[model samples]
Target: MANLDTALKDAMSIDGAIGVALVDYTSGMTLGVAGGTPEIDLTVAAAGNTDVVRAKMRTIEMLKLNDDIEDMLITLGGQYHIIRPLTGPTGKGLFLYLMLSKARSNLALARHQLRTIEEQLEL
Candidate 1:
């Protein structure tokens, strides 16, 4: 299995990848980050997204839906933001956030690649 550093590097290699981060929703902290530009702050983005995750989770609970989230996608005019909540025991309360250029990325392939990386990630 790959460690955090390797996983982050692998994520950065995805076509059109701009930034990625491993974040803990429980505490809104970034455990690792890579490939952010001057205009994009990975840490801030990750922390901010914690609220989104939590909100979705709460909505699910309130609605009494017995389900789990795989990922959430945000489409901007020029970018695609992918937020994948980890499901492994060791990954509890954690997620991987990836940013990609809409013009350069193939969304389906990027999601598949991210899933593979998540499977191999070792904390």
Candidate 2:
């Protein structure tokens, strides 16, 4: 299993990866971050996304859906944002956030890679 630094580095190796972060959903804090350009502040993005996760969780609870979220995808004109909540006992309340350039990224492969990284992550 990899530690946070290795996990973040692995995330940055994905095709078209622009940035990645390991964030805490409850506290809106980033545990680790990598690969963001100056124009893209990963820290701010990570914190802001905590609300997105929280909202979705709240919606699921209110709707009484027994399902769990695997991940969330946001497609922008030039970018794809993926939010994957960690599920292992040590990873609860945290998520892996990945940003990719739409033109260069293979969505399916990136998702698969993220899943692998999540599995190997040691928290």
Candidate 3:
């Protein structure tokens, strides 16, 4: 298993990764972060995405979907945002948020890589 710093480092190594953060949706706090260009502020992005996660969870409960969120994707003109809620035993209210340059990333592969990172991440 990898510690938070190591996991963040691994995430940054992924192709097209612009920034990555481990966020706590319940409190809208960033537990750890790595990478970010002048164009992006990973802390702000992570906090804002907490709303997205909360809204989706509320919707699921209200609708009685009986489903769990695996991840949420937001695609922009130049980037792709991936929000994956951690499902491991110790990761109850946390998520992994990653931003990738659309032109440089392969969405499918990125998703796969993120999943692997999630599995290995030790919170």
Model 2 ranges with Cα > 4 A deviation: none
Error of 1 at 113 (Å): 0.3
> Native-vs-model 2 lDDT?
0.95
The weakest ten consecutive residues by lDDT in model 2 span 85-94
lDDT of each: 0.95, 0.95, 0.93
Give the per-residue lDDT of model 1 (tens digit) for 12-122.
Answer: 999999999999999999999999999888889988999999999999999999898899999999999999998777898999999999999999999999999998897
- Report RMSD (Å) for each prediction in the order shown: 0.6, 0.7, 0.8
Candidate 2 per-residue lDDT over residues 1-123, each given as its tens digit = 989999999999999999999999889999999999999999899889999999999999999997788999999999999999997878989999999999999999999999999988987
Alpha-carbon runs more than 4 Å astray in model 1? none
Clashes of 3: 0
Candidate 3: residue pairs that collide: none
> How many clashing pairs per prediction, in order?
0, 0, 0
What's model 1's TM-score?
0.98
